[model samples]
Target: METTLTLKDVTITYDKKPALEQVSLSFPKNRITAVIGPSGCGKTTLLRAMNRMLEEEPGAAVEGQILLNGDDVQKLPPEELRRRVGLVFQTPAPFPFSIYKNMTFALRYYGVQNKERLDAVVREKLTLAGLYEEVKDRLDKSALKLSGGQQQRLCI
Candidate 1:
């Protein structure tokens, strides 16, 4: 099987303390790979490091290489890298905006300005996340008004 992401000798530290040390992993393309561990293990850290989110954490340090399709993640722009490597948080995090706006925020930031296209993309994404039918009529309502499960689905 082909690999989609690879981590080689990757280590992560926070405030001079290590969270992950010399870890290596590869996720196969089109395959489900689970990183199972006890709570507080480096699973989240490992995932964040893959897309360079680790760099956002204060005092966090990463070493070694993280490659996506053999391309170094460090070589890619943070926005482009994040677009390719999405990480859904364990908790729901809806933006403080309408459901439609929440869905279109990234699209707009990426220069999608056509209203029809934005609507279509919002509908498509909500549908894919199984949220369209639940909140389709309330697209202009605040996303935070949705139930926790609904908000999580929207986040996904």
Candidate 2:
């Protein structure tokens, strides 16, 4: 069996302050795992490092290997790695646009532009995120108008 994600002796530092230290873990393809810790215990830092999102933060640095399906994700393009390992933030960060536009933005950013295909993808993702029924009739409405939970689902 292959692992879906693996972190080997991973460490992250911010402004010379250590956020994560010497952590190793493996997530098997069909299994689920959770990280439970107090605040500032590096849970988010470790998660960000796995997908290399920490690289975007100022003065943030990571050490060691983050492998996705046997390939080093650090060696892959950030955009490509992000596609395979999407992250949903703790808070909703919807775009300042309509409900339809919110999903369309992700599709367009990934170079998906066909109308029918994009619509299908949006609907599919929204349905998977459990927001389809709530916004089915108002896809043209502003995403900001939604409740916090709904907006978070839209972002998912």
Candidate 3:
């Protein structure tokens, strides 16, 4: 099996305190993998480090090689890497916008301007996240109006 993501000796630290110490992992392509652990076990930290979002923290540091399809994640532009690798936050965070707007915001940012394409992408993503059937008739409503579970799915 081919691995789509590989972490070699990855260590994450916050203000010199190690959150994740010398961890190595690999995720196989096309497979659904879960990071199972109790609370405060660095599961979210490990995930944030994968896509370089950990760097946003004031004192966070990551040392090691994170490769996405054999390319160093550090070498890739942050936006481009994030476009390729997305992270759904553990807490549901929907933008203060309509569900349709939330769905198309990134697509528009990436220059997908055609109405047909935007509509199709939104439908496809919502369907994949199992949210389309529930929210299809309410896409114009505020995303914040959704239930916690529904909001999280919309975040996908």
Which candidate ranks first by lDDT, i.e. highest? 3
Model 3, 1-156: lDDT tens digits are 999999999999999999998899899999999999999999999988888998888999999999999999999999989889988887899999999999999889879899999999989999999999999998999999999999999987
Cα-based lDDT for every prediction? 0.93, 0.88, 0.93
lDDT, candidate 3, residue 62? 98
Global CA lDDT computed for model 1: 0.93
RMSD of each: 1.2, 1.5, 1.3
Residue 142 accuracy (lDDT) in model 3: 99
lDDT of 2 by residue, 38-141 (tens): 98788888888888888899999999898999999978999889889877777888988999998898669879889999899888999999989889999999
Lowest summed lDDT window (length 10), candidate 1: 85-94
- Clashing residue pairs in candidate 1 are none
State the local distance difference test value for candidate 2. Answer: 0.88
Better model by lDDT, 1 or 2? 1
Q: What is candidate 1's CA lDDT for residue 38? A: 98
**In candidate 3, which residue pairs clash?**
none
